[model samples]
Every structure is written in C-alpha cells, then in structure tokens.
Target: MAIYHFEAKMISRGTGRSVVAAAAYASCSKIYNDYDGMMHDYTRKHGCVYSEIFLPSNAPPEWQDRTELWNAVEAAEKAKDSRLARELIVALPVEIGLDEWKAILKDFISKQCVNKGMCADVSIHDTDGHNPHAHILLTMRPIDDKGKWQAKTQKEYLCKRGDEERGFTAAEFKTAQADGWEKQYQYKVDKKKLYMTPTEAEQQGYERVSKNPKSTRYGRQNPICAEWNSEEQVLRWRKAWEGVTNKALEQNSIDARVDCRSFKECGIDEQPTIHEGVSAHIIEQRGGVSERCEMNRQIKADNALLLEIKKQIKKLSAIVVDKVKKTVLDFANTLENLRNRYIFNRYEITQNENISTELKQYNTTIDVTVQRYNGIVQQLDNKITELKKMKAEQKHLNPIHIFRHKELTEHIDKTEKEIKKLQNLKSAFLDKMSCKSEKDIPQY
Candidate 1:
C-alpha cells in the first residue's frame, strides 16, 4: 500500500544543528561548513539513490552545488538563534520505480520551494526495499533579483499621525524643549573663494539643501511576508507532497493513491495504526516478533472480526426480511378470508343475535395476528440495532483494517439499506391494519 508520511522540522543554530552536517548525511558525501570551519564527511554512508539542489531562476548558478549553497546560507545568517534550513522528511511509494520517485520529488520541490524563492536540496534514500524516503533541505530566507540573500526580518518604525512629537523616541520626548524635539542640521559650502553655511548660502540666494531627520520610538522587527514559518504553510507543503506522489502513481498506472488527511477529515471512523518503521519491519523479516509485529497481528485479528460481523449482519438481514414478508402475507390472507366469510354468513347471522360473537371472534383473531407481527418486528429491530452498533465499533479499529475490509464495508451498507426497507414495509402494513374498513387491508 502507498502510505502517506511527511514530517517537517527546522535546522536551527539555537538547537546546535549544522546544516552542512545534515547535507553530508543526506547526500552521503563530504562537505565543509565554512561557518564553523569543520568538515562533514559521510562518504562511507550508503543507500543514497539521488541528490540534487534546486534553486530559483534568479539565484546564483553556483548554488546548484551542495557545498557552496549551504555554505552561502551559513554565511548569510549571522544571529546565534538563526534558522539555518527547513527540513522535510517524506516517505516515497516503494511500489514505484527509482526514476519515478525522483521525478515526483523534483516536481514537488520545483513547485513548492524553488518557485517560492527558496532553494531546495533533495535526497532520496532506499537502503532496503522496505524503506524508501526522501529528505529535503530548504532555505528559509528569500533571494532578491540580484541573487543576494534578503533579510528574513526588517525593522519598521511606527509613528503617530497628526502629532507634533510624532516618531519621537521616548527619551527624546522627555527631553524636548518648547520646539517639541524637531531636527536641525548645519551644512557648509565652499564656492567663489569663500566658505558659507547653508543658511548664509540661502540668504545669498545660492542653491542650498538641508537634511530633515525623523524620530521614532523603538523599532519593531517582523518576518518578511513571503517567509514560510507558520503552521498553515507547513500543512500546505505537506498536502502538496501528497498531490505530487499521487500524480506520479497515476502516471505509472498504479492503483494506489496517497492522502495527507486525518481519518476524521477523510470521513473515516477508524483510528490510524502506529507506523511500523524500517527497524521494526527489518526485525520482523528476520523471524523476530517485535512489538509492532504483535500489534499488526492484533490488527489482523480485528479485521477478521470486522468481516465476520459484516457477514452476520448480512445473514440476519436476510432472515428478518423473509420473516417479515411471510408475516405480512399471512396477515393479509387471514384478513381477506375473514372478510369473505363474514359477508357470506351475514344473511344467516342476521337471523340470530349472535352476530356480535362472530365479530368479537374476528377481532380476537386480528389481535393475535398483530401481536405475532409486532413480536417479529421487535426482534428484527433489536438485531438490526445490534448490527449497527457492531459496525460503529469497527470505526475505532485501525485504519489499515478498515482499508482492507472495503468490500465488507459495502456489504454492511447494503444490509443496512435492506433492513431499513423492511422496517418501512412493516410500518406500512401495520398502518393498513388499523384501517376501519376491511377493503382497506393492504395486500402483500
């Protein structure tokens, strides 16, 4: 099955993570971090299927090299708590070929990161056939048209409108005289074998210019509008990976598709099972029973129970339908026969005063028939409700179990519909029985 798994994290200086070391491990190569003057060599590491750097069109061409690109990022960020890179760990569909996986990763990076002025370094790893995944390292800062790093945040001065002391600092406001903390500047100019200040030059009618400086209270620094540091943006990126992976699967004519939605969001009632990671899978393959393997065994058992419940529901539904049909037919026939008998014997009964007894007997028979019908209806209804409750319980099982029992789910749905129709028919029949005239009795 094609599973969906995408995790994102930050490589930050505050956490003591080196982007160069991350890159070395992902690409299985040696790289030097100019920021710390340390060599990150992982040449002995294996299972690196592909690795490449993708950049925006305006970025430097040399940045395509892993060492140069990350080194430049390291040099650009100067703060001790600066974020070095954004890392995305996504699982690839092992059912697809290596080339297809690479193509999918490329498409995802090109649209989600590179097009947004961020450079992406992608690496695909498939050490064993069971575990195939990719690691993407993305630059957090935007690049300008000149291929230079742009500050992730910029300071903005806030000024009050229509105030005499607008933009004045707190200290400047307190020390202001009657003039209200205004700026003053002096400029000297040398012309015609004489030196003159800006005021003197202006008095002489010479072209002179003075500078005006504005005051501002403590400036506030905010992140650039284009930065992807929010939870919402992370969700969008994860969804984008799902789309890319599904598209690749479709292109390769694979039946499987990946989804990034939660079980509730997907309209699935089942709880998702814990992921059996590569290590657990390897352990189980070697004839070792790991915890995950045991969980999987229990999941299989739950699935079997789910299927059995579905089968029981179907069987019980058929039996209820047969019983209801027979009861309705028998009731209708008895009502018809009684109506005919009463009409035929009406002439003889009119001579006697015992016609009331015959009518009472007829009512008694009708009452008995109704009781039997109601009993069957109540029993079947209880069984139907039981089946519904069982189906609801299945929702709390593992999602893998639900996915595996799709056919059983459909069967449950169909059985429920049939039970609903049976209930409606029974109600309609009972309504007809309550009619005042014998001719109104419903025919089954």
Candidate 2:
C-alpha cells in the first residue's frame, strides 16, 4: 500500500498565482482556490495533517503581513466582509481512497461549507496520478449576514502560554492563568473535576495550579500548545498527529494508501498512461498501435489453423475416392463372373437329357451374384456423388480457393497502418507531458 499522506497550507500573500498554476499543470494536480492569499500558503509549504485546512485571507485589500490577517479577523467580529469571504479546502483522494476520504472531509466540514458565504470545492485529480489529494483553504472571518462571531472553539486557543522562559514559577504560574488558579494543571485525581475562573481562584483560596502530581494530582497539559513556531515541536506534533490519525483509520478499517503513490513506492517512476487529460490523449494513440500488434498475432494463428484444416480435408477426400474406385473395380469383376457362369449353365442345360441339377445350381448362383453386384454399384455411386459434393463445398469455404493468403496479408497491412497511427498518437502525448525546464518536474 502507498502512503496515505497529504500536504496543504493556508494561502498567504506571497503565493504567486502563476506558480500555483504551474505546479498544478506540471503535477497534473487540480486547482481549487483562485484567491491570491490561499495560493501563497501552498507554495510556501506551511500545510500538513495537523494544520491541514487553513484560513483564507482576512486582511484588508491594502493590508499585508500576518498581523493584518489577525486584524482583519478581529474586525470581522463586528463587521464582516460583504463579499462572501470565500475559503476552500482542497484534497486529493490518492492515498486516502479519494472516494471515502473526500466523503469524510466533507462530512467533517459539512456545516462549515454550507454556511452562507462559505463553500467547499471537491474534485478528483485528473493529472498524472502522482499526488491525488485535495486542497482546502477556508475563510477565517465570518460573512456579513451570518451574524456576529460567537467564536466557536475559540476557548481552546486562550488556554495556551508562551515559551518556558516566560513561564512563571509553580506558585506564580498558577496565579498567572485562570486555569492555573483552578488547579486544572495540578496533578491530582479529583482536581480535574474542579473549575476555576481567574477571579474565582483568588477568592477561593486556591494556590497556583500545582504542577506536582502530589499537590493537585491532575497533571494535564493543554491540547494545542500555544507555541507552534518551534520547529522541533512542530515536527514532533506532526508525527504524533499523523500516527494518531493513521491508527484511528486502521481501527475503523479504513485503508492507509493511495493508488497514485503505490507505483512510486514499488519503484515505478513512470506514471500510468491511462490517466485523464493530455496524458490519456497521448497513451490512446500509443495504445492503438499496441492493440493492432496484438490483433495481428491472432490473425497469424487463425490463418495457420485454416491452412492445416484444409490440408486434412484434402487428404480425407483422396482416401474416400480411392475406396470408391476399388468398389467400382469389384462391381466389374462380379458382372464378368456372372456372365461366364450363365454361359456355362446354358451349355449344360442343352446337353442334359435327364434332370439337369448342375445347370440349375449354376443358374441360381449367377442370379445371386448379379443382384449383389447391382447393390454394390448403387452404393458406390451414392458415395462418389456425396464425396464430390463435399469436395465442392470444401473448396468454396477454403481460404486458398476464396481469398487465400492475400486476404490475410491485406488485413495485416491495414492493421499495420492503424498501429502506425496509434504510435503517432502516443508520441504526441509524450511530447505534451515532457518536462520543458529544470523546475517543470515530471510526475509519474
């Protein structure tokens, strides 16, 4: 099985539209989002499973930089974009079983996509079948008519903290954050059930959420650590996230590979020729030639069989004729013998003065011989007539009599022409898919 992995990013300003288009063209990959910002995220490679789906540009038209994006998101809380702030999530079904994987993603973001001003575009990759995945870039800010932002899942964001240097001592840390005051961070069995508001912590007589398991007895960290900028942490988080996602998929009996990448995993650098678009066009021509070659192979076998059958039929006909000829000769011998016996019987009858027993016996024998000879002649004639008819039919059906080897030769010629045409077509497709420059990478 090939790896069921996909890479994606939130489009940023730096994503050049031309580059994105070029990538799509070279990889035969699909393009989902046309917005400038979303394109940026893809080229910069800020996408992965954890941050799989990304937010669209929330920055003002003139605004630039991540800070502007944050500001735009903030302003959208009060007043949203008039034009539906469109964001999309694109994916390729290559490794993840395009059909089911896309379905899962659609269901996961169904509510998000259906919301006013929000839309999701899901399409199959029609390229060389290298990275058959999806590209999803959704909006971070809400639309004007959707009402004020209620900030769903925003609470999860607030629980995070700065790096370890900014981290306060155990006592001070508990006092610093609201959850710390509630002892949510403390390692205690029952403390997990307790809730702590920032002000409530000071009034309730709880100290900083103790990190020591002996104190609060609940040692739990926030799910999304506040720091995503650290490269090492990001790598570990990505690995863990992928492992968990893959494990879950396995548990549910879902596949973990894509068809496109399987060939590469098996060391097939060449892409399948039956793909859609230009690649398909090229292969069709080439395949036509290959098909003709295979057809010609069958033609050769058929011709050979026909020739062999004709030869066997001829040999059988000759044997039948020889047997009929011998029957004719036997009929002649019987007729001559009967004539001679009849003559002898007549003489004996003439010479007999008393009862001619010998003559009578001879006469009876001659009659039987004549009758038997007649029957043999009739049967031979019937067989000869039948053999002649069979020979005529065989000649009519035989290739040598009808079209002969010429017909088969003509067929081969026509097929060869067709094969030539297909070869030309294959060549055309290859030219189209060929890499033109150093950056225009070829995808199998």
Candidate 3:
C-alpha cells in the first residue's frame, strides 16, 4: 500500500536557517534522481514554493509575496520569527505510479486550504521510504486585522524588515519567544479519556518534534509501580500478552488500510510497537504455509522430474538395442564368409588326391579358422538375447516402479503419514467456507 510519511517545520526569514529548506534541498538532491526529466516538470507543474502557490488559503498571499518564502528559508543565520512565521504539517498517500508527488501535493493543498480557512503555500515530495510528504508555509498574521488574530509582537515586526535590520543571531531570544508561544496556545490534554492521551496525539509518528507529556495513571512520577510478584508470574504474563499485541496490531492495520484517516485518527498510539508486531505476524504467516499447498508444490516438482527420467530411459534403451543388433548382424556376415572360404578350400583338397605336406598343413589352418568364426557368432547371438531382456525390464523399473519398490518402502510409508496433515488443512478451509453467519465462525 502507498503511504505519505513526512514532517514540516516553520522557518524564520531573520535566522536564514530553515529545516523546511533543508528538507527541500535533500528532496532535490536525492528524490529527483529517480524519474528522468521529471525535475523540470516538477518546477513548472508545482510552483517552486509549492505550498504558497497551490494551497493559497493555507497561508496569506501577502505574507509570502512580501517575505519571499524561498529567500527567507535559504538564509541560514536568520532565526525563525514564530510570531510572524507559521507552518502546517500534513501527510497523504500518493501511490508510486501516480502523477509526480508534487502534483499530488498541489491537489491536497487545494482541498485542505479551503477546509482549514488558510491560504495555500505547499512543498511536497517523496521521502526515502518511498512515502510522499508535504510542507506548508503559512502566514503568521491574520488576513483581517480584527479577525481571530489580534496583533503581532515587536520581535516579529523586526524580523519582517529588510535583511540589514533582521539580524538572526540570538539563540536565547529565540528559545524564550518559542516558549512564550507555547504558553499562550498550548494543547489541552484531558486525563479521563479512555482513548489516546495528548502525548499520543502529539507523537503522530512524524519527526520527533512534538514533546509534551500527558498525565496518566502510569505516569513516571508514581511512587510505586506494578510488576509481577514472581518470576513464574512474569513468564506467564509474557506468554499471555505475546499474541494479544500481535492480534491488536493486525486488526488495527486492516482498519487503517481501509479507513480514510491519519494514524492518530485510526486509534494507533504506539506506532513502533504496533509496526513491529504486525511485521512479525506477517513474516510468521508466510514462513508457515498451509500443509495442502506444501504437498501440492512437492507433488508437482516430483512429477516433472519423473517425466524427464522416463524420456532419458527411453532414449538410452533405443541406443543399447540398436548397438546389439548391429553387432549380431556383423558376426553373422563374418560366419557366412568363413563358410564359403572353407567349402572352396575343401574342394581344392579333394581335387588334389596326392597332396604335398605343405598343402596338408594349409588345410588344417583353414579348418581351425572356420571353428573360431562359429564360436564368435554364437557369442553375439547370446548378447543380443540379453539386451532384449533388459529392454523388457525397463518399463517395470520406471519412477512409479521405483517409488513403490522395496528400497523406498520406508520413504513411502512416511509420505502417507504426511497426507493427513494436508487433509486437515482442506477440512478447516471447508468448514470456514460453510459458515453462514459470524456466530458460526471462531473468534480470536
């Protein structure tokens, strides 16, 4: 799922140093590298001082036009005049494949500016985690002098003056000014609320900017704390609570995914804890697959291997049988040639009645050669017969044959034991599918 996770800070023109400007610079240097030729488009489509141009209602137009948002933020030394500089922070989803993140920022500014009754001046870009973010620069002074805002502080007026008059060097002054702003407009925290506390609301899981502890029953100041009385109890508590947090996080994530609300509005107070729990559960579910799926995958892989083996066996058997046939044929031809030579030599011996001693010796040599040829031809016949038997046995020795063979008997037995596990998974899925009402289904 796509998410926008970002934080915005108000910078002072007097100080010249700005967190918002730094964030912008970082986005330019890092984020711009991803989409080729998108930087120029980003500048044109979404004005450079994004928040001021699109979310016009977020900040007063006169405030940014006179102050020059970029110039004020670019200067590092000028301290921010909280009295004259206001910023609104917001995060919203901009899917990865959607229009460049800057475009989404423009649309969001248009909607939120009108809703909040402020002028729009926004800056938005994707973050390191691929989450998009927006920064809004707002006018500290009210549009109408007698509106909700009454008057501006002298310090704010001085910072608004030209560069020569605005010297940003006073850390102590800035701190005191920030502190005064909080005292006048601090957030109100109600203790009896069962939902989240003020501390939770301020966290918002943005950058670590907001900090104000709320009063709770388990506040740090409590004299005595609750703990398990014994080690055994602690172990029991750990086991019992282990799955509870995971269940809550999973349910919360599902709600957050479907609901159009911020993290705070979604009832998530401890972001880190919830994030960890949900991640762990997802990993666990994936690692431990259903027995039915596992068996199915294994069976498919084995069947493919068996098919390959059978093809190889068929090719090899053809080659062996052909070689034996050729060998037998060659021996038979040699035997025939030997018999013809023997008959010719016998006819010559019979025609010469008064044979010489040398001729008699030649006759004996011919006789022995013929006998050797007969013996070799008989051996070839026997080898051919053996090859034919082996060819017949090949079909019986196929993979199915081997799988059921005595050698693999033990393995087959174990596989049968595992079949029940897959059956159980199928049964459970069927039962779940059959449930017609919520009451019929099991609860956590």
Candidate 4:
C-alpha cells in the first residue's frame, strides 16, 4: 500500500545548521558555504536517486546548479541565528517508477514553492530499495523582479492622528508633520529638548533613526501570515502532498491511493501498525524478534477477529429479517381467519334454529387463532433476544464494525418495527373479541 508521510523542518543557524550542509547531505554531493568559508562534502554518500534545483521564473538561471544556489543563500543571510532554509521530507510511492516520481515531484514543487518565489532543492533517495523518499530544501525569502533576494522585513513610518497613531509612507509622514499634527518618535534622546529632526540628529553623530512608536517592528512583503509555521499548515501541506501523489498514481492507473488522515479520521477503529523501517524489516525477514514485528502480529490477529465478528453480524441480520417476514405473514393469515369465523357464527345464530353447534365451532376457531398468535409472538421474541445478544457481542468488538455493517443496524430497526406492529394487531383483535362477547350476552 502507498502510505502517507510528509514532514517539515527548518535548516536554521540558531540550530547550528547551514543550507550548504543540508544540501550536501540531501543530494549526497559536495558544496561550499561562502559566508563561513567552510566546505561541506558528501560526494562519497550513496543512495541518491535524483537531485535538482528548481527556481522561480524571475530567478537567475545559474541557480539551477546546487552549489551555486545554496552558496548564494548562505551569502545573503548575514545573521548568526538566521533561518537559512525550509526542508520538507516526504515519502514517495514505491509502486511508481523513478520517472513518474520525478514528474510528480517536479509538478508539485513548481506549483507550490517555485511559483511562490521559493527556490526548491529536491533530492530523491531510495536507500535499501524499500524506503523511497524525497527531501526538498526551500528558500524562505522572497525574490525581486530583478532576480535579487529582498530583505525579509522592511521599515514603515507611522504618523499620529487625533489621539491615534496610523501607519504612513515617508512622503505621507512628511506631509502630516507639515500639517501641524503632533508626531510621536520611539527614540527620544533628551527629555529637555523638545524635538530634533532625524537629519540634525544624524549630523550630530546620533546614528539612530527615530521611529514612530506605533509603527510595526518590521514589515514583510509576502502576504503569507506568520501563523503558517503552525501545525495546521503542516497538516495542509501533508494533505496537499497526498492529493498530488494520488493524482499521479491515478494517472498511471495504479489501484492504490494515499491518505494523510489518521486511522480515526479515516473511520477505522483498528490500531494502526507501527512503521518498521528497512532495518527492522530485514531483521524480521531473517526470523528475528522485534517489537514492531510483534505489534504487527497482534494487529493482524485483531483484524481477523474483527472480520469474523462482521460476518457473524451479517448472518444474524439476514436470519432475523427472514424470520420476521414469515412470522408476520402467518399471523396476518390467522387473524383474518378468526375474524371470518366469528362473523359466520353471528349469522348462523340470527338465521338458523340450532346455534349451540355453531357457537362451539366459533369458540374452537378462536382458540386455535389465539394459540397460533401466541406461538408466533414467542418466536419473534426469541429472535429479538438473539439479536440483542448479538448486538451486545458486537459492542465488545471494534467500533469500526458498526460502520462496516450498516445493513445489520437497518435489519435490527426493521425487526423492532415489525414487533411493534404485531403487538398492536394482537391488541386490536383482543378488543374486537371483547366487544363481540359483550353484545352476544343475553339480556337480564
């Protein structure tokens, strides 16, 4: 089966990471970081199926080279704790060939990252021939139309209106100040000095730029919110990958699809088996005992038991439906016959000279009808009891069984409805018999 696994992390300087080192490890090649003047080499590293760099349309064409691309990233980022790159690790479908995998990944990166101005360094790995996956290193900063990297943040000046501060451009700030509205500055060097212009302060060796206190610390060009770093975005990216991979699989006519949902979200009640990587798989294949192998064995057993329970519930549902149909038919026939026999006896008493024999026959017919109704009612009760027992048993099994065998629930509902109808009919018959006896009694 094609499994879903997409993970994301950052190659950050705060965590002691370099984009060049990350690129070297993922692509299994050598690269040099010009910022630190350090060389990172993994040229002897193995198991890299494919490695390439994808850039935006406006980016420099020379950035197609991995060394040049990542070296530029290192050179652009000057802070010691700068976030150099964003990395995504995704599991590729092993059922697809290498070419298909490459096509799918290329389309995904082109649409998702490159179009959004992030250069993607994609590397496919197939170590041990079983775990095929891809690593994508993405740039965090936006690129300009001139193919130059833009600062992640830019400064904006704010102006104070009537008791409220509002953001303004440099020209708007100059106009507002000239319009005689009080302006606020974040850095006030001297309390006694009323105000000093930025140029005067700079000329006097005060190298600080006074900012509006209400102005934002930094403004970002990209519209994406900072909340994109949250778990919700991770789930969204995973789902997106699942959709892309499934589409590719469908295009290739593969019967399998991947889901980024959890077992519960997928409406499955079974415990998911743990992922045993290539090493564990090989060890288990060699008849070795491992925790993952044992867990898998138990999961298989539980699944088998769940299947058996489903079969039993289905069989029981069929039996109950069949029995109810037959019983209702028989009871309806008996009630019709009893009603006809009573009407005949009443006519015989009104027209014939001897009424005792007719009366006796009527009584016998009524008794037989009552006995048949009782027998059918008992059988129905027994069927319901058995069904209830089955339902109770199902409660001990997986909750997934309820979702899998919806017909079983429907049958139970139908049986209960039939029981209610029969009981109502029985009551009506008894009421008719009582009314007839009251009218047949001789006057005192």
Choose the strongest candidate by TM-score.
Answer: 4
Please identify model 4 stretches exceeding 4 Å from their true place. Answer: 156-158, 168-183, 186-221, 224-236, 270-444
Model 2 — TM-score against the truth?
A: 0.23
Which model is ahead, 1 or 4, in terms of TM-score? 4
Candidate 2 ranges beyond 4 A from true positions: 4-10, 14-96, 107-130, 142-444
lDDT of 4: 0.74
- What is candidate 4's CA lDDT for residue 320? 66
Task: TM-score each candidate.
Answer: 0.54, 0.23, 0.25, 0.56
**What's the CA RMSD for each of the models?**
30.7, 39.6, 41.0, 31.0
lDDT of 3 by residue, 1-444 (tens): 533233334445455534344334432322221111222112223222233343234343443442234333233122344323345444444333224345444544454343444444555544343344455654333233223332232222122111222222234336644533111112434432222323343564322323432222322211111111224433442333323323333544533322324557666532221122224445458784333343344444445544554564455456666486775565456556655655665465544434545555865665564444445445545545554554445546666676445444554444444444444543444354464432543322
User: What tens-digit string does per-residue lDDT give for candidate 2 at 321-403?
Assistant: 65877755654565566556556654544455234456557657655654544454455455555545555555566565555
Local accuracy of candidate 4 as per-residue lDDT tens digits, 154-217: 5555555555656665555677777754444434465533233454455565434445434566
Instruction: Rank the candidate models, highest TM-score first.
Output: 4, 1, 3, 2
What C-alpha lDDT, on a 0 to 100 scale, does residue 62 get in candidate 1? 97
Indicate the worst ten consecutive residues by lDDT in candidate 3.
Answer: 219-228
Task: Please identify which of the two predictions, 3 or 4, would achieve the higher lDDT against the true structure.
Answer: 4
